[model samples]
Target chain A: MAGHFKQKSKAKQDIPTASLPDIIFMLLIFFMVTTVLRETTVQVRTILPKAEALTKIDQKRLVTYLWIGPKKLPDNAIGETGVQIDDALVEDLSSVRSIMYRKLVEQPKLIVSLRVDGTSEMGILMDVQQELREAGTLRVNFSTKRDVVL
Target chain B: MPVIKKKERVEPFIPTASMADIAFLLLIFFLVTTTIDVDTGIGMVLPPKLEEDVIPPPIKERNVLKILVNEQGQVLLEDLPSAVGLVRDQVKKHVLNNGVDPRYAEATDKALVSIKTARETPYDAYIQVLDEVWMAYFEMWDSEARQLGYANYRDYVAVVGQDNPIREKIKAAISIAEPDAA
Candidate 1:
């Protein structure tokens, strides 16, 4: 019995860790491949509304976001509603047509995603739509969350 | 004279002990920064700018279901006061009427749901109304698909491409009328 106990105790106790780096490298490569670096920092406050009927935009490359919401002012004060395209807040509504037109020239199949805040009025959204219309970029999406039903 | 001893052999190999730590550091950085949230939304196609010479097609009033939403988020269905929840049933009835109800649409193809909102209408209110309209169409499609031996409309769509005849049979002809300039 003592000889059997001593033989059992001689078995390898530590787990083999030689492949640990390889495993970690595999995980690291996966993350690197799937990672989509966030390019633009959204300046406006866009709390999207919830809805039931929704569709997924699979092609992220084709989408250009147009944010319409109250401006995030200094000291957390909400300023007047504004339209933001990419990084810059649009100062002139008419200029939206030119910027979108230029983007359309680059990528003809561009889909303009309107990320409007729930509390915002429809006036600004309609104006953006008109500009989108003038730009000949007909495809648009209204970004909303999925409404969960109990 | 001193005898020269054999030089001690040293195994030339890269140290792999810290390799895992380095990879883990990078992995953690990416894991912390990466956000895989998929975007979900309602897709729409905006009408192109109309030319001055182009005359818009005129449709009969009975074929169109007008849903007007005011600034107060109050819904007016066909000029009648209606709630947001009632929109789905009403839209379904209007689309599937098929000449049975003179008050509703004449036929499925002739049916057009026009949603006109006020300039000051809340975005959520408008989305709610649009959502109801889309839900009604989706339910109709679901039933149609079930009749055709499919689980749901999405399944049917997956089997048959977007250009299927059923899509043409019960088309979602929703029109968003531009709000008058504020």
Candidate 2:
């Protein structure tokens, strides 16, 4: 302290506080570089049927969506159980294999979640599931409408 | 000659933080480089395990009967059904005809419960159909007055004594799938 004061004769030098800022900057850079940014796209187009009893699924990072469209079911009524997807028509579930294979390659343990119209054909639904299983997507879930009182 | 007589002034002390900054930066860099694991989204309400959860009963894969529901909500057993009303009968017939000896998988105590149902089947209709199958199993057990032995199955039917009703037998159980879509 005496040495420092002895040289305080009308002269001053500034102490830098850049260390904390540098550390914070480095942390931001690290997260930006390593965090996994999942690319999510629905391989099949589907319109979710309206259910007063529908339940909202709560899953964020590890979810893969499979939509079951009403297309190809020749006997289906227009409004009976229509599902909506991005301005695209998904006529078949056979394409699920390729898409799932591509995604599963990235993460083998990924879980696939399906959202199908209530009135969709059981056959198609099962077919989709079978295809996923064949593609090694063993973890599966069905979204449902939890009856809510009017 | 006059300038040489003057003395020089020394600079005062000042603190520098260049090292601290570098250390902070390194710490942040490490914190960001770690990869995080994500959760799997599948959800299932599995049946609770018995006390002997890991008993590892049999190496045999039980025989399964498939019940399919087509787009029109028609129930198909082995690809055909005469009447929705007859579903239970058809299942019962299949279960009974499973050839009772070591030849028949189901009747020989190795039969699997009914097979899987498509996910898009009307939940109500599916539940109704499953209930009917269970009812059929009970009815078949009663009609034959059959009691299972501990050697083949753990279930021992209790004989009716005035107050106690005769316990019915259940065909061997099996698996149903959790469908991916509607």
Candidate 3:
């Protein structure tokens, strides 16, 4: 009877799952390596408008962002829209040219991506464009959402 | 009596049962932290800033397609109140109207689309109009490319744009003036 039981156990082979942990570990390492943390926290409120003609930027490393919209909290109480480059709010408009020029020097193929609020006035938007042009950063993209067609 | 020495051997195994659990925890952490936001938008090349004002060559009124957006978000196509949806069609019509009529574009090469907006015009309206104008040119190029036996305008541009002078000239002909404040 004992020999019969051993024969039945041999016939019922277990599937080997020894390598599954190693595979999962490799996947975990890949995800950890490729993950990029969020860089800058947006200070101003921005609602990008939707548009039909949108071209995606291929190289993210070559692009820089500039945001324009109303300030947050008590600052908004002052009733002045603010322009932000990365983290800080720009007080003077002319300084935009110099700041962008410095960035252009670092990355020659720099593209200025303007994230302007939909409700914002065109005057400030155009001013930023003019500054970018002055800085020789002619490649500009107006960041917008993809228009949803039902 | 003889003195005997024995070899002490022990079996060892690294415990890996918890490895999968650790990996799963890490995977969950990455999944929670990952943000896959893709940046895309309408791109334009701004003309270089000029220190001195220079008079542009006089373009015939017939050859220029003027689009203006006022502060009230009303669109004016050649001083006529028009709907935003009509902008692309009107622009396409004006560009391809290469007829002998003096009031229309003499040819595609001579046509120019000029966009001007009021200072207080909403950015949304301005960008929408600009996007429509760009679409007009894009569609024209795409159709022209298809007629030339290419798959699409992007294919034509990629394969022929660099070495082909005609293709380059055709691309250069479709021009939009720098956006101005009304």
User: Fraction of true inter-chain Cα contacts (below 8 Å) kept per model?
Assistant: 0.86, 0.21, 0.80
Error of 3 at B12 (Å): 6.6
DockQ scores of the candidates: 0.77, 0.13, 0.61
What do the candidate models score in CA lDDT, each in turn? 0.92, 0.51, 0.81
Error of 3 at B162 (Å): 7.8
Candidate 1 lDDT by residue in tens digits, A1-150: 999999999999999999999999999999998898988988899999999999899998899999999999999999999899999999999999999999999999999999999999988898899999999999999999999988
Candidate 1, residue A33: how far the Cα is off, in Å = 2.2
- Model 1 clash pairs? none
Q: Indicate the residue-level lDDT of B159 in model 3.
A: 84
Please state the CAPRI-style docking class of candidate 2: incorrect
Clashes per candidate (backbone, < 3 Å): 0, 12, 0
Q: What is the iRMSD in Å for candidate 3? A: 1.7
Model 1 residue runs over 4 Å out of place are: A1-15, B1-15, B180-182
Please identify model 2 stretches exceeding 4 Å from their true place. A1-59, A71-92, A148-150, B1-111, B116-182
Enumerate residue pairs that collide in model 3: none
Better of 1 and 2 by TM-score: 1
Cα lDDT tens digits for candidate 2, A1-150: 888888886576766566666666666667766665444444333444322212234444455666665443434434333322233444455667777778778887666766765545666655665667667776655554333347
lDDT of 1 by residue, B15-98 (tens): 989989999999999998877887899999998898979988998898999999999999999999999999999999999999
Each prediction's RMSD over C-alphas, in Å, is: 3.3, 16.1, 5.2
> Residue A53's C-alpha lDDT in candidate 3?
82
